[model samples]
Target: MEATRLEPRTLVNGDMVAIVSPASWPEESVPAWIARQVESWGLHAVIAPHTLDRRGYLAGSDADRAADLNQAIRDPEIRAVIASVGGCGSFRLVPDVDVDALRADPKMLVGYSDITALHQVWNAAGVPTLHGAIAGAHGDHVRRLLMEDADTVVEADRGALSAELTTSGSVEGRLFGGNLEMLARSVGVVDFDVAGGILLLEINRAAGLGMVDRALTQLRYSGALDGVVGVALGSIDQFAGYEDRGWTIVDTLRDHFDALGVPVLGGLPLGHIEDLVTVPLGTAAVLDVDHGRLTVDSPSGD
Candidate 1:
């Protein structure tokens, strides 16, 4: 299979970044704090006109959300797009986006959780995106990716690599994955290929071992697990009702993934965890399990 490489564009200081709430709009009380943080980064943060517009659980109407994203992607002045927060409306807006236009004018796109839908769209369109921190997670490790050079590797504490496997080999490929549940939902429809690629996954809320097993089963059934070079499991924030369950998430996953004969590393600081590191979605990265690290290389020269 041919590799799809998306070059990283340089972000100039003082550029305008459009902030859109594709998911549920954050509570109005938090926007000011978020806005101040963005301003401190030396960039003028432009909030989407409908960012605060709410419709029940959604940040705004489907059209409104889609329009904001579209406008941001097409506007050259907006060097990057950062999601305000992730809730539940991004998937609804995906179908209405002009994927072709986004492909033609590739730019930085950042978010996690519900923003996984946009990550899928950008990946399919051959554009790289950031699947790390967003507005709320600005102070997290994701800030390192945003401000540092592409080749920089931000180190996390040993505790960050919670679950450890015994593989030392390295594999490099376009990063493609997000919240496990969201990826599962896009199995049939989204153009995601894990073959020969690093698969990064995370789960939020407390879930039982059975739930994790079921989701992994779906990946296997859909052939999404086939040819995956490495698996990086991010923070499994809250487990729903596993207090009495004998099976730990690590044990359950180890039993399943270890048999697959690939490098598996957990305790990554991504997803719902605080101080999450921003990972470049669709960018080529090298996974070194022995060292308990994932290094993202610049795709500019590829």
Candidate 2:
């Protein structure tokens, strides 16, 4: 049986949202800025205690970070939990998250990049999540996704690196995926599966096509991409022009994706670019590759 589609209640004026640093610690100013932004939407913002704590690359000790997240999850007043940033180390806190509580009182988890680890676990718990930045040029759109009742349609970026790689076909499936490296590392670690979903792939600050090659190869050989109906490529920042041994990032992507034989729609303005468009995971979506469009059902609660 298909898992029932579960959504958190949509945000409303006076609702509380938690800002936590479950991954790497964010800059000190980020919590204040994010709080102001959330308040501007008429929603209250609660900054978790360890949002600014830094223990090297991690936000804090795994125990502290998990405590902050668990506190927010168990709080009946908080309706949404958003990450301050995704520098690194969210994966370690996954096993410690209060998944049972979150499943009982469903709330959206929002962030991307390293936060993809949290997204994986939260999504596996049968809750929809937003793959987006907490604060950026795209914050307004992110607000709409959390607070509004409308479908989101993302058109392909004609000039993006993956734009020319689109294959012809259309598919419908639940959206599933995030940062390519995180997805690769998740194999055998996180129980989240990509089978029967439209896989999303994006990259930022990667070390050329070899890293991309190895990640994709790992997922492919591990049988993670087995029943994926289609793929949507987001920004591959700084790698559009990168060439290694005369092979570009696009060359490496095509070699692996071509083997999957699913319709691929590339260059959608999603992921870690300056003008990012937030997207939801674990929600139903229509991938129309021929028309260069992705129509996704709003994950906002009714």
Candidate 3:
């Protein structure tokens, strides 16, 4: 966990960035629209061949999706890689990631949700990545980080969130984490140990509080959080059933992590939030729970 020597690569106006579908296929018009956004920023957006392929719930056959991502990772001219969207199928593409290829010529890997699997893969190999959208909410944040390699501070209104926390201390460590369910599934399947790092968790869906409890409990029991010092919670989007039970998702989360005895800061506008603030995974950061601030100590992507 020493500082990653994977020096940041710059993205100029003419640089080519690849948008590949690594999970479920996106709607017909999405990739092109995302490409236009990239193009508007003065970078060439190359939609990877299989970005639109549809194969049941996946973007394409596992091999095809993997080939697209591997080629994008290995391509000398593609300066960055973005997932078209997050869906149920990304874990299936994990085996085809070609980590060695990513290690040799690491580029900026960006996306969230299902993309968390790919982010962990690259981060484990010492390459940093952006846990943000490929477009829309915070696309400019992504563009700025990939282009400027800037330090950032993320804060959110604690009163407006469906999340909660415990403790009142500060935790300093490298920042890492993504979709809560995806992270829970990553245990044993991928190298996602959050030990010695501040875990960032965001949820896109939850059937009920019980399901969230089970997911977090599973992650804890699997030893994936062996030495984790703290957690920074972000968007818990689209979850149901808290209101009817006279509770909140925050209450459920608090009950789950209270025993860990670490600072837990919630209300970060990350993951699937409308005003998403792009965060650099695997970068050094300080989580000040008392003040509710997350300060990125290093230039994201650097």
Superposed by TM-score, candidate 3 places the C-alpha of residue 214 at a distance from the truth, in angstroms, of: 1.7
Per-model CA lDDT versus the true structure: 0.73, 0.86, 0.80
The candidate that achieves the highest lDDT relative to the unseen native structure: 2
Per residue, candidate 3 scores C-alpha lDDT tens digits across 1-302 of 45665745768789899999899999999999989988988999999999999989899899999999999988989888888888868888877788887778878787888888888788788888888885555668777887877776887567646444535789898888898888888888887656688988888764776778778998888888878888888877565444537766767777777867788887788777777888888788999988878887543343
Encode model 1's per-residue lDDT on 98-164: one tens digit a residue: 8777767677788899899888888888777788664444464444455544553534345543454
Clashes of 3: 0
Error of 3 at 50 (Å): 0.9
What TM-score would every model get versus the actual structure?
0.88, 0.96, 0.93
Q: What's the C-alpha lDDT at position 101 in model 3?
A: 79
Query: How would you encode candidate 2's per-residue C-alpha lDDT over 1-302 as one tens digit per residue?
Result: 13335788888899999999998988899889989998999999999988899899898899999999999999999999999999888889878988899999999888999999888887788888989875566678778888885577899987778887798999999898999999898888887566778998878755767788889999999987888999999987567567888988788888988999999999898887877878888889999998999988888777
Q: Report how far residue 109 has shifted in candidate 1, in Å.
A: 1.1
lDDT of 2 at 220: 90
Quick one: ranking by TM-score, best first? 2, 3, 1
Best by TM-score: 2
Name the candidate, 1 or 2, with the larger lDDT value: 2
Report backbone clashes per prediction: 6, 0, 0
The positional error of residue 224 in candidate 2, measured at the CA in angstroms, is: 1.2
lDDT of 1 at 111: 88
